[model samples]
Target: MTPVWKKTPKPTELIDRVTQAFRLAFGYEPTAVYSAPGRVNLLGEHIDYSGGTVLPFALPQRTYLAVTPRQDRLLRAVTAQGDAGASASSSPREIELGAIAPGAVEGWLAYVAGVPWAMAQEGLVSRDELPGADIAIDSSVPLGAGLSSSAALECSTALAFDAFAAANTGREPLSASDTGRTQLAIACIRAENEIAGANTGGMDQSISLRAHQGSVLAIDCRDFSTRPLTVDVDRAGLALLVMDTRAHHNLSDGQYAKRRAACDFTADTLGLTTLRDYFESTPTLAEAHQLVARWEEQVTAGMVDLPPQTDLPTARAALRHALTEIARVEECLALFSTAETTEQTWAQLGDLLNASHDSLRDDYRVSCDELDLAVNAARAAGALGARMTGGGFGGSAIALVSQELVPTVAEAVASAYERAGFNHPEFLLASPAASAAQDR
Candidate 1:
């Protein structure tokens, strides 16, 4: 919709920086550089672990890695962070290949070390035959803003190591085939969950590996199936704006984990295995709604006993958001799959986005005041719709705006932040970008 971003810089820009950093840190030029893009979840938040639908788009911003194979069982990993990233508690160091276990590393380095640990566990590469790597990382994706920068780093790490594995095993280097990419994404998920201790569903890694330029991925979190639906918002005079609130979020902090656990508890209360089971087990949305409505009423009546880490109010809230968001996903996908898009179509989608924000704020209880202010300001400035994206507690928000209003709306948001005495948040203009680098 945005003319395929003719002036966007190639991954080569970051590749050059990562290569130089790799050389400086490891005393050798790395064999090759690989990168992966961060993503902004447009809708269907928090329902990922329920095996519900999630819509996400890749950002032009990305994380990059330059890797060299080591003959010995040692990995030298480092990152050249900007002044902003200097607060990271972990420093550059070498870790034994066998010692790359869960909780073996701390802070951001844990996410990096986790990928190879997952690869080995999955038998994608043999521990004995694996060539440990020296890697240097660099990223433009903003960290801890609910934008999925961790997935970007894990994906690039997977891509780089996959190539090294191919060379070691006499297999061809990693290709961009859908199946191969999906498997790699799962590996990345394992890294985040098992090693990095993020405990998330696989939506972030799936989007990182499966995103396409000018499209949004409608992912079925159950089986990791995805359909790339065209998001020609610009053709209808609309644009997608990511407003980074600069209020950091950490998924490992137990609240996110608590939400996932609550969803599971709701599913169990509904006599189903997962939240998406409503669609698979019931014949109609009305029937399913009736089922959860009973539980909701019970929850409201204080008849149900919720876990100590959660409460009846929280469980009721989780169930309400999950059922409604799943229906919204189906409706949004149906409209998006239409042959041609019009102004009316974009308007309907905008309404869905706004509804999504409301649910995330009130039902999911994840939106913070900073995120709320950004969305409200964007809408006040003529955005069609605005909503908090990602895991929500103090993160970023996305707005659907007409292209002509982008500058004016952006200015209004900054002015509001200034007037409120909050830091002027980082504004990112995003359409879709390609999922992975070109086939190697």
Candidate 2:
């Protein structure tokens, strides 16, 4: 049977594998093994940076870390073959932890080293205060699948090292600290930005660190606050089909930054700190759009300098995508809150998703041919709705379909990809990605 990256099989089959890899890499057993899940953004894309809201849930697919705390401050890292955080290899490779520094560690382990480096820089722990450890990793989360494999890898390493630090000094678990998950998420963001060199909007880190079991987190980018919403995905006999188009996206490229710059330019031109701020002040979308139009008039009249590196069209589209995606989150909530959600209700939810994709694809211009193909194929296979998720130059598209049609939709997508002569893609059903328990 295939091993899933979810919170199943109690002690975790991946942890067992990671433990064996740890022993094989070093010479003894690990201190503790920990894991963290990746996530799928159900609604809202590229909106988090504009201080808009997003709905996302952690996936069962996750990343893992097995570590042994050391009195000697030597950081030795190894990863199992086929691990999410490392290159595919026939044997493990080790990196000394002492060599780690911000903007230094590259490849898959940069994200791992970044956690401790970030924490130390923040003075949460001094450089010498951090104990050296032998760390080994294994994961089922597929890298570059637009499923937040980076966040999962970072969080798992963060929690593992945090727990180890606590054990050595006898302090409350990091989760019990007043700082809690938010602080961890921030640290992960720092690592991703400053270390991993991925300038992201923080939705991935927040959901991976803060999402609850069996729930989607509604995150307000305004203040990084989150609310858990229990989605009855199974109640409607529906499944979220994740289609990894294998069209990997490198968000560090100019495209992701270009879109973000446009959003920021729009907000600045409108005299607001963020697009969310403008919408918050305006009572309705029409009024906000009207106000934005006025601002564009000012720019055209040379009454104010237009924000740099963005045209009026791109700026307008960015703001529109941000506002509409936030609205979709509310629509999804209302649909799920009805007295009795039926298949038809799900179809309505699907329509909202379709509208979201149209906006992202047409207005935001994030969807590429492969992503469009995945969405079209899933819809052709009878998906209630389908859309591309993640940073979106190309990564993955998600489809909402009845549980029974999962295979059919998946097969259809695969066949379509083959017909297009693209690489064969991977697919999986949606499941809430939960954090691991201490005892379990």
Model 1 quality (TM-score): 0.92
lDDT by residue (314-425, candidate 1, tens digit) is 6666777888788777778878777798778888888988988898889888898889999999999999999999987887898999999987888787777787887668
- For every model shown, the clashing-pair count is 0, 5
Which candidate number would show the highest TM-score if scored against the true structure? 1
- lDDT (CA) per prediction: 0.80, 0.76
RMSD of each: 3.6, 3.4
| Local accuracy of candidate 2 as per-residue lDDT tens digits, 1-440 | 11122223334677788788888878799878778888999988888888877889988777788888888866777765343334544444444556666667676767888888777666566566578778887777777778888888888877866776677778766655425667777778888888887878889988887878888888888789887877778877898988888887877667877777777776776678877777554234465467567767887898766557667787666666777776676667766664577767788879978988888999899988899998998999899999999988788889999999887888888888888988787877887767533311
Model 1: pairs clashing at backbone N, Cα or C within 3 Å: none
Clashing pairs in 2: 5-60, 6-60, 58-433, 59-433, 75-97
Q: Tell me how candidate 2 scores on lDDT.
A: 0.76
